[model samples]
Target: MDLQKRFDKLKKLGLCDRCLGRQFARLGYGLQNYERGAILKESKEIHKNIFSQENIPQDISPKDDCFLCRGFFNKLDKYEKMVIAALTNYEFNNLLIGTRFPQNIKDKEKEIWEVCGDQYIEPIKTEFNRLLGKRVLKRLDVTVEFNNPDITVLVDLTKDKVELQISSVFIYGQYNKYSRNLPQTEWRYKNQYSESIQEIVQAPFVEASKAKEGKFHGAGREDIDVRCFGKREFVLELVAPKKRSIALKKLQKQVNMIQDKVEIFNLDFTVKDKKKELKGKRANKIYRALAVLSKGIEEKDFKKLKQIVGTIKQDTPQRVSHKRAKLTRKREIYKIDYDKLTSKKIDLTIKAEAGAYIKELISGDEGRTRPSVSQILGCEAKCKRLDVLDIEK
Candidate 1:
């Protein structure tokens, strides 16, 4: 049918101009369906076909329900108010709008597309999204984000409910753990001596971000008895934070106050993608361990320790096998240098691949680790104190 015929046929079915205009959505540019519908209703061709000037109004109002939308476009104001009210509690600069329409609404849309061929007519969801975003920008003075929106508003038209999904605010930094008893995160078992690194770090951020909860993400973990001397990478995520703007320096300073446990530095605002990147990275780590020997070690023992280099196979340590799956992992010991402190004690500096259990590499973990310090020296050995010196990328 021609434009005039299609317009006449659609108007006769009691569809509002907004609903009628959407049927030919792609036919023009720069004007909305409401504006296009008003233009068509007042056009010379439409007016000539319908009635006289005085009898015809400037705008075409629906006499009954809209054939396509069933008066959905008319209820945009109500849905907009519901979304706006729901967003008042959150502090967001940009947002994306999502919808949950009733099954009948979707079925009606499909029916129109089947008859109209989907060439010019806009999808009901597309129209609703554009209309809602435009109104939100005008009323709330916020930007419509297509990617990485600060907040995502879901309008459930079926249940007449609104839900706000706020993205977690990430803070990236490096932490130095001074305490030996502190775990990288919370352990299932409690330690009376000290708190976990997560508990110490998250408390300050939760209060600073004004968020409901906080989680800590470390690049890799250290044992409870191991101390981190260098800056170990980490990211802290604040979930549904009301205050997104907080000084990184201030956050760093506040977190460092618990100096007895852990001190975090280089604090800055980061995104969730950084968490994935950090996790994907595998870096070599330098460790200095003070080990105790069961017997006296001669000068020849240092030469024997150097021979314990290269690819060493290690099974999961018996101490952690109950918690971790039993699997043998092959890790390289790039270099192993030692200094004599006493006949029974030696300080060993090791440069090894990531995930190479240093303590197990020293003790041999009852033969689970091959060519270890104890296996090389032909005597029993155990790591008394371990400290991570550097993490090389």
Candidate 2:
């Protein structure tokens, strides 16, 4: 509890003004540690002053060579330049500073804390980040964004290297998949090129941002074979983008012009949380499905489709059981309206709840689904082609 005893103990360890000021960080408000340490270091004549040590150890140096920081604090200019040089390739407005202390330095800091008692002392890492961030702010036109930073400058004292961690840029929009062959995300068969709606949707944004890659996050994804005619909300996450600013209309045009298979619209800048929010919203789907039947013809068959409206108890489909948990879920069919295409086939417009296995609902998935279209028709039924016509508001 004795301030003088702690000050004297820290001084005996050959700490610089910054390191010394850091020990009493809680004592002064709105003042850098080094300034406080300088005032205390220069004061003399006892009473309430920090007396200058006349006979200190020969091995222990002053500000240029301190036992605590080991001259690290004095080299802020060097680190600032290194960070700026690293930032040359990155375009970031909100940045954060991080520090990685060497093990030896950490141990030394712990020993210092033990000797002086860490009652009101700030950790070395905190001071390091603060001091370094202060240095960067003076020369650069950037602000420190703690929650969500565009980029992070990591000054690893162990390796003595400056590393930049550029954050992903998020773009919110809606997309329609015209091609049924394309998957929602990238497909890999060890080493094979597979085209997808995700790749197609992100092509222009990635090109503009000069990002390393792009990831697609949809509100709810449809099957690979199912074509989505309705606009599905999505977030395109571009990783390590050198440029955050995008020409929205131009990028949308480039994406729409790339191919007729996929079209993106209303592209706008979004935060990282938008991805989570987009995924959390569950929306029902209206599907226009082509159902092929084993038995043919009758107006009575059209009436059978009406019986399918209500709660459907469905088990996990065989196709997706490998990735999804094998569990029974209760989903619903809001409405079922059909147009008898031929005696053997019919076009069904079904409004179903979210997460309802549409294919399983039609084929009944080997009796895995109850009150299904296949069960209602009194014959074997299979969905040949499916298209999402609309998403319920």
Candidate 3:
């Protein structure tokens, strides 16, 4: 159908300026639909279609009589007020506005599309969001963020209700755990330790943002008995945060100063994708372990410790078998350095692939770990103390 002929048909349907202009919305740039409709009403096509030389058809219809929108656009002000009132207790920097029209409104628009051919028309929902967004920006002194809005206001014209969805705030950083008793994240301590590295880092963020809860994401985790001197990447997510921002540097300093178990640095605002990336990332690690041997370490056996390199075949240790799958894992041992601390003990430094169990490597996990430190020394060995020295960049 020709655009002019379609316009004549829509004109007879008693559409207001916005509804009529929306039918030809794609034809013009930098013009509102209402303005476009008004402009088209004076065009030569309108002169030929519905009016004689001396008579013209009604160019604009009253709100209540518009067959397409049925005065829906007129209530944008009411919806905007409802949105503003719903946002009274929240704090945000930017927002996105959306609308849900009644089924009848959708049906009316579909009926128009069947006749108008819909090739160059803008959706009523699209126009509603844009107009309401502009109104909100002007009134609230805030900007509109389409990709990642801090708050999303949903207006339901059918119910005449407004609802809000507040997005979670993500913070990225690295943490160092100094206490050997603390777990990497919150878990049952078995009455071992009441605190955790995650709790220490997330308390300040949850408190400052007034969030309902906080979740922790780490690049990898360290065992409860192993202190991590190397910085481990992590992301803290605050759900339903009332406020969007807090002083990053100040908060980092506060956590570092107050927490004896864990300290954080390089704290900065981040996106949701960073959390997924951090969780998937893997890095090599270095560790120092004190292995207590069942017998005295001979000089020949000590030299064999240097040969603890290349691929290692290990099964899940008995200690963590309940949580971890029972299967063999192959990991690379990059390097090993050892010193004879006493007749029955040795200080061993190891660099290996991530996910390799250092405690099992030293003790051999009752022969679950093949060619480990105990197997090399020809005796039973157990790690008494362990510490992470570095993580590969």
Candidate 4:
């Protein structure tokens, strides 16, 4: 049917601006259906005025009702103001607006579409998002980002109500814990430090780097009892960061001063583009573990075990079987060196693949692990102190 015929049918059903423009949603870019419908409605009015002398019958009435959007289109200004108020404290460049309507609203939209044979009506979410997004861009001077946006502004338009969603910041960096007894991330308690690892790392970055919040991501995590002696590869994803190109060396120094136990290395700016590659990259790690023999053992026994350092074997540690499915894994021992800390204690240095269980390798886990320190020496061995020595890309 012609636009006039469609308009006439819609007007009989009492359509709102948001609902009216939604019928031709695909025809425009950067404008809401309500605005589009209103423009078309005005054009029809003008045309009617120009041809009023011809005595042609008008098909559609001036007032219209939209089955899909109801009258919500006229309330765009109110929704925009609410969004602006919600975003007062946040600083962001790119944003995405997501609209959520109540189940009843969505059902009404769907019912309208079904009755109209799903011909021209746009989704309620699309219309709301477009209108609100345009208003926000105009007022805030911020661009809309579809992929990896700095902020995600969510609008929930359900039962004449609106809600907003704020996106989080992502920061990428490597951190090394130099001492034990410090949690890898943050320690939270009701009376004690309730802050997360991200909170601790974000403060300095926000101040020194002038960025937003920071999210800490590491290749793997170590136990709270284990200390990271070398570089622990990580990426601190900063969410909606106001600044980039941070002075990593200086930031490292400052972070260390705050907590001498934690050290950051290989700090650099990473964009959303590189996140996939960063997550996929594999790196090697070295660890130094203080091993304690359950019984007295000869120095010659330790030397004999070093002979099999380069061998690869299957290992399955029992301690982690609960979280991890039982599976045989091939791991290689690249290098091994030991220093006699005492007659019953020794410091063992090991270079292995990224996922090798260093503590398990020393303890043997009751023979569940092969080529382990306990199995090698024919004496039960246990790890007293574990530390990551190095991380290499």
Candidate 5:
């Protein structure tokens, strides 16, 4: 049968325009289900059965319950008010609306579609999203965002409740650590309190953004005793921020107050994807170290050090094996150069692949790594001071 015939046939069983019009949701563009249903009901194309105003059926009345939605459309005002109240405390630019209908409501939708032969019909979820989105925009003056919305309001029609989910805010920057005493994240050493790079960089941002919590993600980390001399990239993700407006310059100044330990620069707002990039990044590293040798330095030692090129197979260092699994890894050493400062002390520069253990490479780590400085030179080698000079892009 044609659309008018189908509408006339379905009208015999009670349905509201919001519910009845939804069956033909995809047939018309830029028009809501209620408008479509009202048009169909009053159209001369469909024959109407006449009953006096006093004898009209209760199911056909405008205020009657919807078979498909169970009065959900009639409760839009209540749902909208609940969502608005839930969003009053949050600051956001764009918004999205989600709904969870009861199982019986969904079953009714399926049954209706099956009886109507499922032609040009949109899902109930889509209609609810658009309807709630329009209402929220009209009231809150906020635009709808399908992707990466600042906040999402969830309406649970099953329980007659509303919930809100706030997206994380990402900020990107480069930082330098002047103190070898600080770790990249918080550290608890015995009873003494030690500072960390994460605390220094992210603590102020949490307070400034009025967020519940914050996490720092670095491109790479330096050891507690090794200083990061150059710009080290990082991202700070703030969760459920109440204050979206932030002045990065002022926050940077606040973060840099502990200049004696660490500093941050080139800071700016970034996106959530930055965290993935940092996690997947494997940039080469340049390091400078002061090495103390058991024997006096010789001219031939420099040549042997230069021979420490190509792939070096290494097992996890003993110092960190307690926390890390014992596994063998192959890492490349691009180049090795050194300058003698004393008979037993020398400055060494190394360019290597990411994750190469410089300290273990110098000490040989009790035969855990092959072709190390100590193994090649036949003496014990120890790194006294180390600094990361550069990280390749």
Candidate 6:
């Protein structure tokens, strides 16, 4: 039958174009239900004109009530303008638009589909996103990003709200924490300090690097008590950056002055593609730990540790079992050097695996860790302080 007749029946029950077109979903491509309904309405009017040899009655007004969309589909221009205004503060090359509808609207659409015996019908979300996306593309002139969009404009029609999801800015570089007692990322407290290491580190780097806010991603992390001494590989992902290129040497110098513990090295610009590749790569690390013995030990026992240096069987430490899987791993000790600082304390230098649990290796985790410094020497050895001396790629 003609859309006017169908509208007469569907309108008595109340139906939107998005709702009406959903019943005929199998027809057309790249077109929303409202657009499809509009086309169907126009075509039906044209058909009546030719057949009856007179103008068909304008029985259905364009502003007729729609059960599903509630006539909000006609408000596309207003929503598009809102999105453009929301995006003004951020810089983005690609964007994706999303829409959400109320439960009642969806329920009404479901009722219509059921009445028509589940014929081809488009979804409410599909029509909303597609129509809004098209309008945004035409008005804003921004490309759509499927995998990693610079911005995601979420149009929540259900509550009449709009939200902008901005992607983070990315920067690849190496960092060296000259001093100790700082975490690589922020440390959160339930009732205390809420800022993290990244917050402190990135603010200066953002100003120095002349980019948006930055997020720090390192190949690995050291204990909060430990300091990063040499070149530590890191990637800083900036979010909605205003500027990209900056003087790296000067920025590095500026970073050094603010926090004596943190410094950016090998500063370079990088794209999103490079960031993914660096995520899986590993780098060599050097650690210097101060070992304290329960009792004074002779130099002879220390030499014995050097003998078995190259062969160390390490497994996942028990202290980290809550967060890590239980698995046994073997790592070459590379080398071990010790300098006598006192009778009870000695400076120990060790090079091992990238993910090695260095602290547990010294304390021995109550015999769970075998061939440990305490196990090998038959002495209780504990790490008083640890420092990451170097990181090499």
Descending-TM-score candidate ranking: 1, 5, 3, 2, 4, 6
Q: Model 6: per-residue lDDT, tens digit, 333-384? A: 7777888898778888988766766777788878766678888778799999
lDDT of 2: 0.82
**Which numbered prediction scores highest in lDDT against the true structure?**
3
The CA lDDT at 248 in model 1 is: 79
Q: Relative to the true structure, how large is the alpha-carbon lDDT of every model?
A: 0.81, 0.82, 0.84, 0.67, 0.81, 0.68
All candidates' TM-scores? 0.90, 0.89, 0.89, 0.70, 0.90, 0.67
User: What TM-score does candidate 3 get on C-alpha atoms?
Assistant: 0.89
Q: lDDT per residue, candidate 4, 115-186, as tens digits?
A: 544555578777668768998898999898897676677766764454444444444577767655555455
Q: Give one digit per residue, the lDDT tens place, for model 3 in 119-173.
A: 7889888888889889988899999888999999999888889988999999999
**Error in Å for residue 62 of model 5:** 5.9
* Per-residue lDDT of 356 in model 3: 96
Residue 341 in candidate 1, Cα distance off native in Å? 1.0
Off by over 4 Å in 2: 28-32, 42-63, 188-193
Evaluation by lDDT, superior candidate among 4 and 5: 5
* Residue 178 displacement (Å), model 1: 0.9
Runs in model 5 deviating more than 4 A are 1-5, 28-32, 42-64, 187-193
RMSD score of candidate 2 (Å): 4.0
Find the 10 residues in a row with the least total lDDT in model 5: 48-57
lDDT of 4: 0.67
In the range 1-393, model 5's lDDT, one tens digit per residue, is 466667666676677776766777666456657655666666545433221233222344444356676777777788889999999888899998999988887887788766656676777777887788789889999899889999988999888889889998999998888887877876434234456788778888899888998888999788888998778899989999987888899989977875567888898888999998988899899999999999986887667898788999899998889988889999999988898898789899999999999998898998998989999888999999999999887
- Which parts of model 6 have CA positions greater than 4 angstroms off? 1-65, 117-120, 170-172, 188-200, 205-217, 235-253, 257-259, 267-284, 289-303, 310-332, 337-348, 355-386, 390-393
Per-residue error for 169 in candidate 2, Å, reads 0.5
